[model samples]
Target: MTPPTGTPRPAQAAEAPARGSRLRKATALGLAAGLAATGIALSTEMTAGAAAQGSLPAGTQLYKDPNSQVVRWVAAHPGDSRQPIIARRIASQPQAVWFSNYSPSTVTNDVKAVTTAAAAGGQVPVLAVYEIPNRDCGGASAGGAPDLASYDAWVRNFAAGLGSGQSIVILEPDSIALTTCLSAQQQSDRFASLSRAGAAIHAAAPHAKVYMDGGHSAWNSAPEQASRLRTAGILTSADGLFTNVSNFNTTANEVNFAKNVLAALGNPGNLHAVVDTSRNGNGPAGGGAWCDPSGRAIGAYPTTNTGDPAIDAFLWVKPPGEADGCAGPAGTFLPDVAYALASAGASDPTTPPPTTAPPTTTPPTTAPPTTAPPTTAPPTTAPPTTAPPTGAACSVSYKIASAWSGGFTTDVTVRNTGSAAVNGWSLKWAFPGDQQITSAWNAKTTQSGANVTATDLGYNAAVPVGGSTGFGFQGTGSNTASPTAFTLNGTVCTVS
Candidate 1:
């Protein structure tokens, strides 16, 4: 795998938009309100300004991808203190803006600001419908939508702000699978709200595609989740089901599990999936906990160029820098930790944080090698039917709510939502309208015509079941329109 060459964040000026643009949305979701392609869109101004900000960037794919043995080696041996920033630089991907931790009104403005910026930058923005009732399902990060009416209203407001096009929405976490945690009545209420939310988004922004959460592979099996989605009116109301948001499952496992879920959903032509590549570099292991787990680097960001049929693009839905509960509080931001994460390439921290000090303070010979086991697994349910094969005509029949930073990276992430492993994988696409590939990671990439593709190597072949690998890279560009169409393994991952 190649190493990343992306630079560090530059000092910011006042966050403002030029001519005819809306003032920057001061909401937590605000920034360019403009998201990026490959689903890794973020607001640098938001992240930089906050005492503790949590957001992934456009080329987060490259920053998060662990495609570099060189960077990995340097990271593994942080010999001196300078390595943290070096690690951050080494881990650098295209950055994004954020707007989390805002009040309802602020969220509205945040969304609007980012959207405006995205339009100005011509980049697509990544929107997460996190305000669901009992959102965390009472888990550690357990806090979300308090009521259906309010939840629906929030989604409605969010939907209303979709500026023109080039936006991706990852709606609700633990909304579907955690149904078991709630009463039948409660589940019904939330699903009804989600159904309404999906419909509203589609209606308000027909150009914007909204995806429902499918949980992670560890939580729900495809068929089971499919049943939940069907009940939630996924087939009829939303674009398709989403998996691995805010969790650390591998892309391979997510791919297989998603394919199974789609199969259970009658494999509708309007179905597809998005994998959360914010983390999961080594794939989830050592019991499923999402707290900046050990050995977890970044996974693939958004991409229309995946080599699968059933999957659309792998996205960084869970804003990377945010804490996954367990640490301090859920969704809260911690900059020192962020700096540490940036430095060590922030793979999952399997054991708890060191009590006394960082490993560097202690003697190297005394320190334990800090690698954690993986946490990959198959879908929780048995497939009712055989899953789709690798590169086969994917049954993806949904519009991709995507984010992109132009082209491929060395350290990339790919999942096999289809039944079989991709015999070989190559993501290729031409720049749409004003967009272009700025950088890539985790894999070698090449561009011809408008077509650009990233090819995986032996170490990163056929994403293992429910497993995700992150790669990194660097490039140059300016345009920012989310790719509308993509082909996985030659077959198109299209909206029905």
Candidate 2:
């Protein structure tokens, strides 16, 4: 991700607008206010059965695709060590399907299949419409329908597949956030195209909740993003805004950021927000490195029960384990990376609710405290007995992820195996060969001779029992023997 310019704070925008624009804004404001105050049911024309199944009602189950990349990988490698955890944590969750390819002819059927299945299962499906021209600003995820006209046609065809079911459409990630790459005319053309795209989707499937990109918490200021969104016609064309798509920013920050953007957009109570919580469990890496940074983990599961009324749901807009072009080719799924993210997130179940609303799902069971020995005899006869403190224990897996002639990259996974949670951690190990550390991500590393130490950053400091976290580094040396031992907080750990 580009370096953050500011936090999600409100800024000013002029009230000036043309007459037509003023009328449209006023109408939207009344519609939103009426929906909130009266709890009025959405009309059949306004929403397909989507209000019940597609709008992600509280405690609603999101559709889990049986043929997702992670599911196929899990089925193929049933015996892999990471299979169980990945299958349970990553594959089982509902995530968005991207219609990123610019095939107008087949896009309809491809989308229909997913929506059809979700409709049959009485679940909501999240779809990401990303075929905008010059997508990603000519970065790794570049290329789209060539121009605005073709993009409008493609989006119309894509909308045909909503299948009268409940669906959430995340329209063109990075479309607004990365618009800096376009010239003034290009930007206007793109915005017009986006506005048309939203109109087309709603025209075809009024039930589909179309959310425009509000960028992430760290990128554009709230007012600037709101201004861009306004120009793109978010207030009329889309249901709300989505933040942190495929980016690792904290849900808390994204929530605050999204609220700020909504306020700047006029704060119609009906225009809600959803956060991409797929890979933000540990928040952003230090320095805001966006490309496949290590130690990152999965955020909250896909749930519509976001305690906050302003926030609608925590959606997994970006599938987990997809490389951001650093660890591998962009969009490539790496099982090892997926395992680390799941393992790191699996242990901690106490994710604070986004607001004061009580948790929807029951919390994980906690270990009961040990009972002290019965004091049958007088204290003078025997000293009062007490339970021993639980010591930290963990297992370390060291893998050489990639290698070359003079240098190689490695990923080390540390899993908590103790009965108690690890509040903070420090991993120390000695290299078997003359490998000198060059640089690292996820952890702060310092090497002396063959010995190396990696400590947790601010976000990744805690390790609940059975939870895992990982860090990676690049080094120079011919010798690449895996370290045989590791220590977490001074306690020796089993090697994998």
**TM-score top scorer:** 2
User: The CA-based lDDT of model 2 is what?
Assistant: 0.67
Q: What is the C-alpha RMSD of each candidate to the true structure, in Å?
A: 23.1, 15.3
Q: In candidate 2, what are the lDDT values of residues 270-387, reduced to their tens digit?
A: 5778998988998887655565556688999988999988888999877776655445445556676676688778453333322223234322222111111000111122121123
lDDT by residue for model 1 (1-496), tens: 0001111211100110010000011111111111111112123422221111112222322222222222344456555543444344323442223222214554555567656766665556665555566544444433444567766666666776775665666666556766545665566666666767777776666656567877667765566667667656676566676777666677898888888888878877766776766556657634343444434556664454567667766775554444443222333333322333344343423223323234453212111111111111212332222333654543222222222355221222344455555544555456565433332323445566567765543324345444344333333345444445655556564422
lDDT of the candidates, in the order given: 0.47, 0.67
Q: How close is every model to the real structure, measured as TM-score?
A: 0.52, 0.64
The residue pairs that clash in candidate 2, if any, are: 54-166
Clashes of 1: 102
**Local lDDT at 203 for model 2:** 78
Candidate 1 whole-model C-alpha lDDT, 0 to 1: 0.47
